[model samples]
Target: MSSTTQKHRNFVAEPMGEKPVTDLAGIADVLGKRLVSHGFDRAYIVLGQFLVLKKDKELFVGWLQDLIHCNVMQASNCWQCLNDWCSEFL
Candidate 1:
């Protein structure tokens, strides 16, 4: 079994429901603050971007990397979190 982070599991286990960007996996306080400052205060906003990117991993990862300067692993984690959420909820 893959060793998923608790954060990832928690976020994917339920509806996003206006959760803060920080609630997403791999988005810690610093990154969350950066996202908020850039007008991505909510998880849905990021999900909107992900959908707009057509759910392409590269595009979504690149967008997050560009927007927040997150490392590849961090971006990938966020991508996986959103992807799993979509799989369950959308």
Candidate 2:
């Protein structure tokens, strides 16, 4: 499968703990830096945003684009990662 798929699986398979935002699928170093600069340094922090958005894909995807100017594919990957993680853990 694709690298993003692997990333999604790996992210969803474990407790997020203090994993850096970069560990999340589609959050590359540059995007992760942007997110960290905006106070979303950890995966769990991003997850919090996902939860705050009520896990609505549109809102979360729009928020990511608005916040960091990420493309739809990246934001979608991140949303899917969080969704799967929630399904497995919460």
Candidate 3:
């Protein structure tokens, strides 16, 4: 039952070299801005956090939620986006 958005499709389609954090699925302007303010201004920085969390769904989702009050769906979408990106590029 898992699925993704066009955002997700576009993200995982290629190497995410130096892309903005907003380019990740579910990380729109507000979230991206917050992430940027926290010094996680890039996709690779967020990806590093993802790896630091060992790609664990619950941990990553909780981190996103705690960081910028993102909801479950948003966090999950971002997680899946990163996970899929890793599958292709990492």
Candidate 4:
């Protein structure tokens, strides 16, 4: 997995704008393409799903794992990243 401290810092520090799904901390090349293929092409699109699920932590993490095969740590990192982004940005 890629280091997220920097990635997380960068992601939350600015408006998401048009950043792609891969810009998300846990989503590397393979997972980013998978997400795009699944119609989640952008970071905001995934965030939309997170909002659609009402920001439910377990549900979001479970969805990431079940749908994209994110491991436990990946899901956890993603969940925390998004949550913090929401706190700062939303």
Candidate 5:
């Protein structure tokens, strides 16, 4: 079987308590900083926005594109991260 990406494994490896958005895999340093500037400093805070969007893929993707210029893949990865994290912990 093929292995998962380090980003995927690392994110799923723990409770995300207080981890900064920058710490999330697939989020580049520039994007992470932009997210922080927009008041999404913590991973959990981004989780809040994810939940607020009710996990709708289109909405989430659109929001990310609008807010941070995230490409489709990056937005999708971030969405998956939050969705899986919620499934595990929320």
Candidate 6:
């Protein structure tokens, strides 16, 4: 089985609380800072948008690509992270 990174595991392992978007796997400092500037400083805020998009993978991925220039892998990872978090918490 493919193993998840420690960051990914840690993020999905509990409540997001106020963790920043940068805290998610594949979201580097530069991207994180940019997201914050765009009003997505917190992980939950991003999650809000994910839900707002009706959890549509295409929309979420496209939004990530447009907002942060994230590649498919990066966008998918972040999307899965939030998706799993919602499954557990929301």
Show how many residue pairs clash in every candidate, following the order shown. 0, 0, 0, 0, 0, 0
Residue pairs in collision within model 3: none
RMSD of each: 1.2, 2.1, 1.2, 2.9, 2.1, 1.5
lDDT for 53 (candidate 6): 98
lDDT of each: 0.92, 0.92, 0.93, 0.85, 0.82, 0.86
Local distance difference test, candidate 4:
0.85
The 10 consecutive residues of candidate 5 with the worst lDDT sum are 1-10
* Residue-wise C-alpha lDDT for candidate 2, range 42-64, written one tens digit per residue: 99999999999999999999999
29-73 per-residue lDDT for model 1 (tens digits): 999999999999999999999999999999999999999999999
Per residue, candidate 3 scores C-alpha lDDT tens digits across 14-83 of 9988999999999999999999989999999999999999999999999999998889999999999999
**Model 2 misplaced regions, further than 4 Å:** 1-4
RMSD of 3: 1.2
Backbone steric clashes in candidate 6, count: 0
Off by over 4 Å in 3: none
Once model 4 is optimally superposed onto the true structure by TM-score, how far is the C-alpha of residue 5 displaced, in angstroms? 1.4
lDDT per residue, candidate 6, 2-24, as tens digits? 36677888898999998988888
Q: lDDT per residue, candidate 5, 1-90, as tens digits?
A: 124568766786799988889767558799999899899999889888888999987898889889999899888888887777777777
Give TM per candidate: 0.95, 0.94, 0.95, 0.91, 0.89, 0.91
